[model samples]
Target chain A: MAVEQVAMSSPDERITLTDDQRRRRRSRSIAIAVILAGLVVLFYVITMVKLASTAVDPSL
Target chain B: MAYVNDLNATEPVPGVSLATPRDYFELLKPRVMQLVVFTALVGMVMAPGSIDLFSGAVALFAITIGAGASGALNMWYDADIDRKMARTRLRPVPSGRVAPGEALAFGIVLSVGSVALLGLAANWLAAGLLAFTIFFYAVIYTMWLKRSTPENIVIGGAAGALPPVVGWAVLTGAVGWESLVLFAIIFLWTPPHFWALALLKEEDYRRANVPMLPNVAGAAVTAHRILYYSLILAPVGVVPSFIGLASPVYGVIAAGLGAVLIWKALPILRSAGTDRAAARGMFGYSLVYLFVLFAALLVEGIVARLGWF
Candidate 1:
């Protein structure tokens, strides 16, 4: 029955995704967002460290 | 938006449409960018002065972006010729995945942003070299020499060779002989490497009217020239060891790889324009030779820092 329904769909309408595929895509998107956020925080911390190091006097 | 009305507004959106994230990334020519980044990193690691991890990362990132900007601009300008070439027909601009205007804008923005950020993160000298590299590739090579001369790759190779120099400058704030040697190796390697590929793709370049060496000078002359360049490239590849920048191991490996490169070129020369496989082999081996040579240098640098060498 599922094969018959799939065969009946037009080529243009064949892009429909299964529930599992949609869930996987949503998980991928969230993973990417988390990674991006982590990178941003890392950059911020590095910049702060750089600034703090530059502020210290090396002669002492 | 209403000012430009068309009855036949289509799905592809008739020029001035949104591009996918992947399409924008494709405009960067990631493979070329990888080489640029790796060479630049090697330069940074080999330089005398030390850079903190954050600053080094920033400098490398800026160089990567600058290289990508140059690639995008080249794609934008060469869209017509690219459409004619089988290998480049599917590029973002030529394939109509990204509009030329959009590409130009993207490139310009990244070029300025990268240069400015590099200047802020590193020194102006490194940033200046980065700017010049982008301009040399986009304007001097792509706009001028590529269509006009058979010696295009020879002169244009300078832009590609500057990344290591720029990398060294990022830490030292000035160019040095060590970086110059790296630059020389790449500068000399470019002709032989590219000409080998051009041997195989001569017809495509001829069809596009690009005046590549094989297309203009005939394949036999091009093959001979590749051998000529390879001879010079071999010695230059080993210079880093003599100068104390790399270990003797690197020198030996570079010499062996260089000999193999010359050996690969020999078949192309003897084939008398008939050996497509020989040319392809030379092209493939050239890439591996460069990667291995540089990787050897990187390992030498690491070992030296660890005081194991």
Candidate 2:
């Protein structure tokens, strides 16, 4: 079931999202959220690897 | 605002976005990205020395996203021409599923993000190469050459060829001689492969006013050029064996594939631009030739890595 949404397109004007638009927007939002989470994990792991590499190599 | 009917609304509405996650993904030209990732991986595998598994994976990720960013930018810039071509008419920007501004923003974000991530995850050389590749494809090729010149695919092929070099740089932290051989193979392969498609899509390109080789120089010239490149490519494809990057087995296979490519090209040349079937056959085998040739190198790389040599 697609849920319709009420969004403010302007300060004085209200724009309504049709159910399908709302559904697609929700999916897009979810995808973005997931990708952001993946990036966070990637950054964290890469940082740890870099730090560990530096720790093992002291001759800089 | 969504002014369209609420029931079963599949079409995009003005000022309202109906684009799904899939439509956004389509903007990246995933098939092209697949080829990019594959070739870059082959480069990564064949380079001297070894990269840690995690770092290599991350580098590949960066390259993949960078390629996608370029694809998105190309879609945004080429939307008008894309709309005019039947093969590309249904692309996201041309179909109105994704807005041009959205694609541009998506591309820019991914481009920056990928470069930064690559710099952090690997070395700066690979990151720089990825950034340059994106710029060449998006601005140099898509925004400039494609609209202006018939040799667009030829010069633009350089951007596509750089992936392996970038891949090599990722692992070795410097571009290797072996990688240039990889680069040359793809660089030379691009014209024949594209011109063959141009033969079939001559009308589409001409209707769009794009000066593809076939549309500008005529099909006979294009076929002759294809023969010339095919002859050069067959020998170039076997260069990796002498360089010790590929095994003799792979070199033989590359030779066989190159021979098949030439055999396919021979028919096109003999047909004198009148044969669509010959062009199609050439196009189809070209794909197989590159795939198997690369797959063989990948296999040899894996065997060497695993001490199976």
DockQ, structure candidate 1: 0.05
| Each model's fraction of native contacts | 0.00, 0.36
Candidate 1 per-residue lDDT over residues A1-60, each given as its tens digit? 011112223444232333433554566467558757965775686577567667885542
Residue B296, candidate 1: Cα error in Å is 0.4
Candidate 1 local lDDT, B3-86, one digit each (tens) = 222222122334234355667788889999999999999898888888778878988999999999999999999999999999
**Model 1 segments beyond 4 Å from truth?**
A1-47, A58-60, B1-12, B15-18
State residue B306's C-alpha deviation in candidate 2, in Å: 1.2
lDDT of 2 by residue, B1-309 (tens): 433234334354556776889998999899999989999999999888876789889999999999999999999999998999999999998888898899999999999999998888889999999999999999999988998999999999999999999999998899888899999999999999999999999999998899999988899999999999999999999999998898899989999999999999998898876699999998888889888988999999989988886
Q: Give the Cα error of residue B160 in candidate 2, in Å.
A: 0.7
Give the clash count for model 1: 0
Task: Give, for candidate 1 chain B, the lowest lDDT window spanning 10 residues.
Answer: B1-10
Best by DockQ: 2
* Predicted structure 1, TM vs. truth: 0.85
